[model samples]
Target: MLKNLGTARSIFLVAGFALVMGLLGPMPAGADENCREVSLPDGSVKIICQDDGGDEGSGGPGGGGSGGGERTCEFNESEIACSSEFGVWDGRCYARVASPQPPKSTPVWEGNDDGVILECNPPGCVGGPAPCPDRSFYWSPTAPAAPGPSAEELAQRAVAAMNLTMGEIGSTPPASTSDPNAVGTIGLPIWLWIADRAENTVGPITREESDGGLTVAATGTLERTEWTLTSASGATVGAITCDGPNAAGTPYDGRNSAEPSPTCGFGADLNSSPGSLTLTGTAHWVVEWQGGGQSGQITVPPQSNSTQVRIGELQALLRN
Candidate 1:
C-alpha cells in the first residue's frame, strides 16, 4: 500500500494524509484499537514496536502491557508525515532523544532525518512539549507524574516578574514641580494627581491538559489600589487610609472643574515645616491566579513605585 515516488526526502504531506485517511491503505478498522506497543526492561533501554494488524496488547517485540505504564514520548507534531519506522537497534528499541539524527545527506527522514519512514500515524500520540521530535518506547509499572510546578504556577511567576505600576502620582512626573499645588504646600488647594494606569500581561502562557493532551490555559490576575503615605519629620502625621483607589485616583485627568477632591486632596498647615515636605504614594496590589487544578493569591509588598518631589518655597517677584 505504501510506495516511494522519487527522492526519499520528497515525502509529500498529502501522501501522509492519504495514508491516514485510508486512501493508500485499508483504514485500520478500529484505528487506535490496532496501535499496539510493547516495552521490556531489557538492560537500561526497552523495546517499542507498533502492530496495526492485531488488537490492543496483541502484537510487538515483547507484546503490549496490560497496565500500559507511562513513558516519555517526544515528537514534532506538525510533521506527522515524516514518521520513522520504530525498529530495534544497537540494544535500544529505537533511537533516543539523546541520539542525534542521521546527517542531512541520509534523507529527510524523521524530523531528525532517519530514512526508515512509517506509513501510518499513532492515535493520541501526535504532539507534546515545546517544538522537538521524540517517539521512543518507555516501560513503567505506572504512568509517571510531571516533575515540576504546573503551567499555571509558571504563568503566575511570569506575571509576578512584571512589577506593574500606576504611573506617577502628584507633580508632572512625581519629581520636581514648579507648581505648589501639585506639591501639597500650605495655602494652596492640592488634589491627588494619578497618572494613567500601567497594565501588563505575561501573555499566552501554556499549560498541560489532562484530557486532550497538552492545552494552553494561562492563569493570573492583578488588582491594585492607590494611597498616599503622608508623613513628616520622620514622625507619623496621618495616613490617607485605604480609601477605594477609584475615588482617590486621577484628580487631574481632564475633569476641568475647580471642585475640591474630598478623598486625597487637602492643604498642608502653614505651621508644617517646609524643610521636610514629603508627599508619597503607596500602591496596594492584590494578585490572584489559578491553573492546573490549583489556585493561589499573592500580596506583594508595597514599595519601589513611590515618587520623590523636591519642595522649594515659591517666591513671588515684585515688579515696579
Candidate 2:
C-alpha cells in the first residue's frame, strides 16, 4: 500500500493537484497535527507549518509563527518595529538624532612685520596692560544729546567774528561815467564805517546780482565844495569851485528808476576809541526816500564791500 501511495502522490504532484497525506491513519504523538491551507485563485496549493499540543514551532511565543510559521499575523499601519541592525542607528525606534560639530575661532589682527597678541573678553577688550599700554585704544560709549545754539546768539557771534577779520572804516571804488555824451568821468565815493579792528570791512559786491552792489551817493557836502589842484609843474593853483550842491542839480540820482528817490545823509564822525575801534562790530546801512508823495524805508542788503575789520591792523594804523 505504501508503494502504491508513493506512486499516487507522484502522479498528483506532476498533475498540479492537491494531495493529502495520512488521511486514513492517526498522526504520531508529539507531532504537529494542525494544518494550514493556502489556495491561489489559479488553483495552486500551499502547505504551511503548524503548532500542536503546546509545541512551539518556528513561530514565536504567541503562536503567530514568525518567519516560516503556521499562524496568521496582522500588522498595523501606525505601529512599526525595526528588524535590521542598521535600522537601530537610523532612529527607526524614534525620531532621528543629530551629532554636533565644534565652533570656529575668532580672527586676529596683525601689524607690519610683527605679529602681536590680543586678548578678548565679553562685550569688548582692553588692549595690552596698564604699565605698557597698547599703541591704540578705543571706547564706544553711548553718546550724550547735543545742545544747539539760539538764532540771535549765533547771529551775534558770526557778526562779531566777521568784524574782527575785516578793517574798520574804508571807501568803496568810484563808479564809472553814466552818459556816453559826458566829457569828464562821473564818479561817486562810498565811505564805510568800521567800529573795531576785529570786524570784517565789507561783504562781497557783485553787479551780476544787481547794480553790481554799488552805492553812488556821497555822504559829505557836495555843495560849498573846495578844490586845491596841483599842476605837473609843482605849482599850486587857486582853489576853485568846480561844482557844488548849488551847481549840480540835487546831486544826480543814480538809483534805479523803479526805486524810490534815495537821499544821502550828512557825514557824521563815529565816536570810537582806540580800543573800541579795535573791537569787532557789525556794519549796517539804510536807504530812505520820498517819492509819489509817499515816504518809506528800503534796506540795502550787506554787500561784499561790507566786511569785518581786525583790531590788530587798526592799532597799527593808530601808531602810524
Candidate 3:
C-alpha cells in the first residue's frame, strides 16, 4: 500500500527500471485499490496509479478521447480498463514510447515545465492480473515531436550546463611586478595570455542529457583566444589571436622576461598612454556532441576576460 504523495504522477518504466514523478498532494478515496506499488531496481518503491476516466474527452494530442464511443475498450476486458489518458487505442494494445526526457529544471525545450506523461499501452492499463510487458514500448515518435528540440539541441543544452568561462588575463610583467610603481618598460615586450588553462576555462570539458531513448553528450574545447591590447586612453596598441597548441599562452619566467613571448606578446609604445594599459582576451570554443546515433559540432558565443597593467617609460638610461 502506497501513502498519498502527490496529486498527479507520471511513471517512466524503462530498461529494467521505473521512475515516478509527482509532488505532495492528497489521494482520493479508493485510490489504494486503484494504485499498485512496485519495488524499483534500486530498492526504491514506486506507486503506479491508474488513470481515472476523468480526463476523458480532454481533447489534444495527449488528451483523453470522447467519453461514450471508444471508452468501452479495455486492456483485458475483464479486470483492467482502457479509459486512461496515457495512451491511445490501436486494436491490440497502445503503441507507446519508452523515452527519457530532460527534467523541468533544465528544459531542453523552450517553455514547458509541468512535466512529461509516461505513455503506456492499453491506455489506463498499469497494474492488474496482466500488466504491461517490460521494454515492449516503441520510441517516442510523436510525443516530443516537431517544434521540439533535436539531438543537436540537447547537445547545446549539455554544453550550456558546463558553464564554460574565460580566465582573468595574465601578463609576463605580473601586474604586481613593481610593487608601488610601473610594472612594464614603455618599449619592452609584455607577454599576454588567458591565465589558468584548466578544463573549465580552456576545455576538453564534457556534459550529457538523455531524452527520447537517446542520450546526447557534448564536449567543448578552447579553440583559440583573441587578445587585444589597448592604451589607457582606449586606443588599440596591439592584437594577437592565439591559435597555437598552447593557445592559453605561456607564462613568462624571469629567464625569458626580456625576450618577446614565443607564444603571445606585445611591446608598449615609447609614448604609450600616460597610465595603465587594458588587456582583453576573448576565448573561442568549439563544442562537439555525439548522441541519437549521430554527431555534430556547435559554435558558442565567445567569452572575454580582461585586466589592467601599469606601463611606464625609462626617462634616462644610465648603464656602465
Q: Among these predicted structures, which one has the highest lDDT? A: 3
Predicted structure with the largest TM-score when compared to the true one? 3
Least well predicted 10-residue stretch by lDDT in candidate 1: 74-83
The deviation in Å at residue 218 for candidate 3 is 1.2
Model 1 residue 289 distance off true place after TM-score fit, in angstroms: 2.0
Per-residue lDDT of candidate 2, residues 1-320 (tens digit): 99999999999796653324445343333354454333322233333333233322221112122232112222222212221111111111111111121111212111222322211111111233322211111111211111122222233333333332223322111111222222211122222222232212222221110011111211111122222222334343222222332211123245432222122211221211111111112223233332111233334333322222111112224553
lDDT of 3 by residue, 190-259 (tens): 7877677778787778998864344687998889888887886788877878874667787777665567
Error of 3 at 33 (Å): 42
Model 1 lDDT tens row, 1-320: 13455544356776777777665544333455434333212212212334534322222222111232211222221211111233211121222232343344432232333333221223333354322233433322222222333334454554556554444565322354544344434344345655544443111222322221212233322334444433455654333532444433545454533444455554344214344445566555455554433456656565424554433456789999
Q: Estimate each model's TM-score.
A: 0.40, 0.15, 0.51
* lDDT, model 1: 0.38
Q: What's the candidate order when arranged by decreasing TM-score?
A: 3, 1, 2
Ranking by lDDT: 3, 1, 2
